[model samples]
Target: MNQTIVPDSQARGLLARLPATPRALALLARFDRPIGWWLLFWPGAWAVALAGGGVVRWALIGWLLLGAIAMRGAGCVFNDIVDRDLDAKVARTAARPLASGAMAVKVAWAWLLALCLIGLIVLLQLHLYAQVVALASLALVAAYPFMKRITGWPQIWLGLVFSWAALVGWSEVAGSLTLPGLLLYAGTIFWVVGYDTIYAMQDREDDALIGIGSSALSMGRHVRMGVMLCYLAALGLWGGALWVVRPQILALAALLPIAVHLGWQVITLKEDGIDPLAKFRSNRFAGLLVFCACIVVGNA
Candidate 1:
């Protein structure tokens, strides 16, 4: 029988040189996919940039990137553990380490703990207020894996969890969460929903067969419209965030580039094959555009 590789696995080059045990563990944490960490890191960076910490808080951005990498790995490990059975039933996921029995649950839990330890170190680097804000996201993270089983809009719950770094980044720099921070967080939630829906397109048939829910499945033929609305809401909220900080007309224009990029994604989106995956990965670039916008608006 041929080995089925997970379609999105980027485990090659240096990562491919690791031994079987380590490779399986790395894949379990999704270290093979750098895009996940990039997506997870961008929101915090954007918040810090928008809050006017673009220069002075450079070290904080680095620490947040560390935290994002660790925490996102931990989350992926936890999610794979919880979804192992479900994953086994999905063709796209059936090759995952946990689903394929390449890694034991106990070992995955151990790796999860190791990653969380790294996250804890990064969390300690923040001030008391920001630390508290960061801790508050634990509940959201803990509940995320089960969202698919119980709700059609699991992406919304994911939005809440994934976009949480906005609050952390803003509070760490500004010493409190304010309207601008809240708006950035809200906009990031919509962005997460939009892109994650695209990612879910790869699993629609398997997800339906397995009786799980996803935004892609929920929207059906209207998926493009759904993503467009989500992108529009994100741009509007982000514009509000920038305006709250600078309160000038040009501040809003900071969002124009990202708006156009998102528009391009929607305009060219294809619901099948590699198009969805390509568009989903393109958000890494999208995140950079937003970060540049934030820096421009906040520093002006």
Candidate 2:
């Protein structure tokens, strides 16, 4: 039986040449899939830029980026540990390090701890207020992997998790969350819901067979419309965020490029095959577009 090999597998080329011990650990953390970290990083980037930031803000963004990478790796490892059984049943995930028994549970836990240590180092770069806010997300992050079993919309829970950097970024800069920051967080939650729904497309049939819940399965025939609604709401709230930052009509126009990009994604989305993955990964660019808008509006 052939399993799906997304471009992010670790059992290939140089990665495969690594010692078996490290290779299994790397695969468990999904270190090859930078898209996850990139998606995780963008919200914090957007918030920092939108706060009328300067050089110090750029430095902070660097810290947040590192935190995203480390924490994202940790999250993936934790999720793999939690979902090992389910992953073993899914064709797409059957080869995952933990699911395939390439890595031991105890070792996976140790790797998770190491990555979280990296996150702690990054956290020390932030202020006390930001540190507190960042640490508060632990409960949400801890509960995320189990969400799919109990909720039809686990993507919603993921949105809350992935979009958390917005709050941390805003607090790191401003020392408190404002209306604009809240709006940015809300909008990013919608954006996550949309992109992750596209990602869930690959698992819809398998998920149904296994009785797993997902936004893609929940959307059913209306998956396209569901993604479209999510993107539109994201744009609307982001627009409101920009307006709050600067009450100028031109500030609203800052979202034009991002709007066009999301429109393209929604217009071209397919429920099957690589298109969904392509569209889901395209959010990295979507993030950059939003960051540009935030820079324009916040600095105006």
Candidate 3:
């Protein structure tokens, strides 16, 4: 009998079309789900672009992008290894390589190691200070998979992990963390919280049944307002970050476009079916809009 892949499979994109063997490995790394890596890469890009990289920082941006994809893939593989049972229980994740027994645990470990090696190569491309800052996230990354089992607001932990690139990116350019860098990190945390909550909405029912916890369940009927607050806080902090970089009144306005995009997500979001996932994925563009804002502020 064929496996039941569930509704979220539409988001699988090209991964769903591959032959079963390689597809499982691709799914394990979430290669088909470019949005995850894009979202992960953006904060770093925003930081670099904000530092006025222009043509000079293009190579650094490329390295950061490679690091994002590799490390994000490694993180997913590690998360799956830890959450295999949980993923099997969740309808949306039931067909994942590890969850469905399509990939062996030993093989997953090898694949994870391979991905981490790529991340290590990218890490070497960073400066000494940036390298240390990047390595500091290892402990946080190791702890993330267990957050959901222990806390109602696991997305908060995820925010810490996902937004870590701000430190790395800024350090790569500035030699250490700065006022703008810290604010950028803090702002990206709120953005992650908002979007991951939206993504969590898809598994609300299954998560509840499986005795799991998430921000979506914690927020309950106040989901829209909760996301709005997260976005608002993100814009406020990010706006401040920009202000510190270049203290122009108009510098603050750079965030307006993405703020509007985030607002659209909140306004159009429905708690049912794919609305949440669609809103979640739309964040890739949201991230880009903010990067553009950073370019304007940092370069101008």
Best by lDDT: 1
Off by more than 4 A, model 2: 1-11
Q: What is the C-alpha lDDT of each candidate?
A: 0.92, 0.89, 0.90
TM-score of each: 0.98, 0.96, 0.96
lDDT of 2 by residue, 229-274 (tens): 9999999999999998899899999999999999999998876677
Residues 1-300, candidate 1, lDDT per residue (tens digit)?
Answer: 222347787767756688788878788888888899999999999999988899888999999999999999999999999999999898888888889888889999999999999999999999999999999999999999999999999999999999999999999988899999999999999999999999999999989998999999999999999999999999999999998899998898888899999999999998787899999999999999999999988788
Q: By lDDT, rank the candidates, best first.
A: 1, 3, 2
Off by over 4 Å in 3: 1-13
- Reference-based TM-score, model 1: 0.98
Candidate 1 local distance difference test against the native: 0.92
Against the true structure, candidate 2 reaches a TM-score of: 0.96
Please give, for residues 30-86, the per-residue lDDT of candidate 3 as tens digits.
Answer: 877788899889999999988878447999999989999999999999999999999
On TM-score, who's better, 1 or 3?
1
Better of 1 and 3 by lDDT: 1
